[model samples]
Target chain A: MRNYQEILDTLIDVSKHPLRQVKEFKARTGHKAIGCFPEYVPSELVYAAGMFPVGLWGGSVENSRAKEYVPAFCCYVLMSDLEYGLNGTYKDIDAVIIPSLCDTLKCLGQNFKVAVPSIKHIQFTYPQMRKIEAGVTFLESEYGRVLAALEEICGTKVTDKAISEAINVFNDNRRALRRFVGLASEHTDVITPVIRHAVIKSGFFMEKPQHTALVNELCDALSALPVSKKGKRVLLTGIMADDDAMLNILTDNGLAIAVDDLAQETRQFRYDVPSEGGSAMHRLAMWWQIFEGCSLAYDPEKKRIDMILEDVDKYDAKGVIVCMMKFCDPEEYDYPLLKDALEKKGVPCLYMEIDQKAEAQAQTRIQAFSEIL
Target chain B: MYTIGIDIGSTACKAVALKDGKEIVGSSIIQTGTGTSGPGRVYEDVFKAAGLMPEGVSRIVVTGYGRLTFEKADNQISELSCHAKGVHFLMPQARTIIDIGGQDAKALKLSPAGTLTGFVMNDKCAAGTGRFLDVMAKILEVDVGELAELSSRSTERISISNVCTVFAESEVISQLAAGKKREDIAAGIHMSVANRVAGLARRVGIEPDVVLTGGVAQNLGVIRAMSEILEMNILPAPMPQLTGALGAAIFAYDEAIKLK
Candidate 1:
């Protein structure tokens, strides 16, 4: 059996080179890979269609051709995604699934069609009012459309049993991740911020069941050891906190991420599809309804703020770090209210803007935050 | 025991030596910082001024941009915490602090007990910083130190609409070409910086008994404009630029005490 460090090293390598993962997986498994864009795109359908589901969270690439398609004000993630597609970095991707979680994503999907005509584009809009029956029904139909698109790309009919199996695989991965993150908080000396992020992000590149097995083994290995003393525990809330430079600053300041509301990390695995409710597509739609505490998912009461506050108390976090994604409208709109809520509750919060193209300058602010903690 | 604190900022390096954590023994400020040899020079200058050998110092704490790079320091602390400690030592009643450095502007909220409770900073922009004033001074053909005097003599208020340093430089050149008086343009530049800094201060929710500490605080014109914009009297700290260094020294003293 592999040790936890060995497992962690593999995850980190997979995260650092996702393109390599995709190529190796395709070559090994003889499978087509479908690219899924940020926030949410149902990858289970692609898995059911017998294809690899690759996550296209924007990378650290220079923007040149994408400039023609997107305005300079677009968020770095979408801009880089477009740049990758335009520059043929995602040429191996058979079909790209784009969700209209925000305005920039909508433009990205449209631009992907025109700019990267070599690859296929599949676009879907998530319902903002996901709590009600109408929203569920609408999303179920949308999932049907996505399933149809994936089936067309792979030239295979997706059976309900395959999707159910795929859902089981994904649910197992989520459960493994939930356990790993909890165990990670207790073993931060081993799982630094970067390691924690890599462990979670590597799930995006690997087959779900394989990732699940590795995470479960790692969690068991961690559970065998004694819980380490807590350091300066901090809760991170944002669209994402995967940047190496920012994560290095957190580690340098001796801050351990006790929990996170990051859309890319915890947000992806926090909710599972109901095993016994309606059809497989209906179950996926229900998963959307159950999903709370996301800026993209509209909630009138802003339950995300309350959830964050609770996480801070539960995890004994000294403060909260708001990794604001630059030009991200949904996250930007939610920040002021979140700040107000955290302040009223007497929780210290630091807001740091995460821009892929911008230089790293969060050192002073994060250091000061650590001092106060 | 003598504790030393050094702050290597973007454009200035400051050092302060404290005796037994209560009394200031010596302080020095050098106008160069960061990429230059300012850190080494300030370290030597502070010990010389204090009439103490480096070996006799109980602890050395560094702050600001160059803190990480300076190898001689025993400990490193953030400028924000150091500023809070320094300000609280000087004036315990201060609840809010606005610090404008070479390339960044920050607003810090303090508790009644002088603990730093909250803070906000400008994001990778030089518009609200000391560099903004330097650029304006160079374009206007005057020394940066003379900006306050020049702005005070202005009879009219000219507005600089652009807050971006590059665009604002172009705007300033346009005003000069259009034959606007240098004093009015200088006054406009101060207001622009004041407005930018005030925006950051408002984000952190400025409280009463507000104090300003930084190299930029030495400019009386900026203080006047900031006071008007914030709608509150802004007190400039005595030896404003030394606050970060003093705070570092205080931290060093505390660290030494803990060791003992």
Candidate 2:
């Protein structure tokens, strides 16, 4: 079996230095990289178009130039994205695909052209009424537009067969990640919060097949080890939990993330595209229709609450930590309802505001939450 | 057996010593906290006041923002759990606790048995904390302690609408420029803090027999405003600043017993 520590270290290095990974991928594959913005931009289209797809979830960069483009109150993720673009951090990416999932993201799409200008920008809107037939058609057409833009950039027509194969690759990767997360929960002593996040996050910068193989190997290694006694388990739900310092606070307090519903992590892979849908693009769009329990996904029934409670029960979580991204309106709106439902069920919830630029003062709160648990 | 608890908060360092985990032996409060000499100073002061040396103490538990930095602590607990324990000991009937410390404000829900059920805290903002009051008092050119008396004299209500501390300070200056009474502004400042804190309390779905702790609990003006807003009697902890330290001491005592 492959050494899980070596695999984890490799994934962590990729997560920590995404630009280096991007450079290496470009040099190794000899293909252009396409940037995909957060919450939901389909990367399969880029993969099918014979190009690389990279996730643009922003970085911990200082924001002097981005402040002039976007307002100061915009979410830190988008601000850092703009900061990276303006600062030439994402200059190598040929084009960026931005989805209008929230108001700030819509604004970021418009601002990207003015701020960056060097890289081409492709923007699409996800249908909010996704369960309807027309909504699925609309999303398919949106994905088609994004694909056409990618084809123009790459100068290669993306075939349906290629798209189908790309979906298979992504689906396999998602399954491997789900397995890894479940196994990681049973092995917290081996998988600290930082290491768990790095392993998942490295997928953003890696090819899907490569990430799947590494994750599968790591999972095998983890399963071969004896199941250690579990520590304090908690569920994290929000836009993202990407900050290393904040995650360290959780580890310092002996809190292990049993599971997470974060947009940047598990939310991307909880559901896979149906292989038997009408078309490859339609199947990809149908994946969104079936997706539930996300703040940005427009579920009026508030399935996220039920989903969170179920995960808490299933994983035997002692509490739920809402890693509320600062200035993230969708996540902010979902918090009160989530908190009430959790309280009704007697599940302790901790609301933590996550800011990429701010110092982590989460130690006191996490320690206190551990005590409560 | 003697046990000690130390709370090194944002602006203050407090310590409490307990005899056999029940009787209060000694306590100390220093005006400074982390990034200064406050932790060590308070530790020495508590031992001195207790008429005991460091060697006599069985265990040392620390809480608050600076808890991790206090090297002598046997273990560190969160101020929320500590505050709940301390308040439960002082007021057994308390079901909700609103603590406004130097930098943050938190509202904690408690079971009838004094266990922490839920909690909500202000996020990286000073508007609902003791630091807000200190800034307002400086802007008003009055001692922070005098705000309670000044607010009591207000004949008319003044509203401070801004939730940001810097913006609120500017608004307070504008109010003073408009010849508003200092007492009315003082009342308005207290009401602003009370509103912010009460919103946090409501998040946890406040239960009755609510008690207030932290250094800000010592301010009657805030207490009166909070009571009016929450529409519940708010009992002040007997020694507001020492509650966290006291709770840490209780935890220390419990741990010592377990070790034995």
Which numbered prediction scores highest in TM-score against the true structure?
Answer: 1
Alpha-carbon runs more than 4 Å astray in model 2 = A357-360
What DockQ values do the models have?
0.82, 0.74
Give the lDDT of residue B195 in candidate 2: 96
> lDDT score of model 1?
0.91
In model 2, residue pairs whose N, Cα or C atoms come closer than 3 Å (at least 3 residues apart or on different chains), thus clashing, are none
Off by over 4 Å in 1: A357-359
Alpha-carbon DockQ of candidate 2? 0.74
Docking class of 1: high
DockQ of 1: 0.82
Model 1 chain B poorest 10 in a row by lDDT: B159-168
**How many clashing residue pairs appear in each of the predictions shown?**
0, 0
Task: State the lDDT of candidate 2 residue by residue for B1-260, as single tens digits.
Answer: 99999999999999999999889999999999887899999999999999999899999999999987789999988999999998898888999999999999999999999988778888777999999999999999999999999999999999995389999999999999999999999999999999999999998788889899999999999999999998878999999999999999999999999999
The digit string of per-residue lDDT tens for model 2 on A1-373 reads: 7789999988998888888878887898888999999978899999998888999999788889999988889999999999999989997888999999999999899999777889999999999899999999999999989999999998889999999999999999999999999999889899999999999999999988999999999999999999863668999999999988888888888899899999999998999899896889989999989999898999989998899899998988989999889989999999889888887898888888888843445777787788888
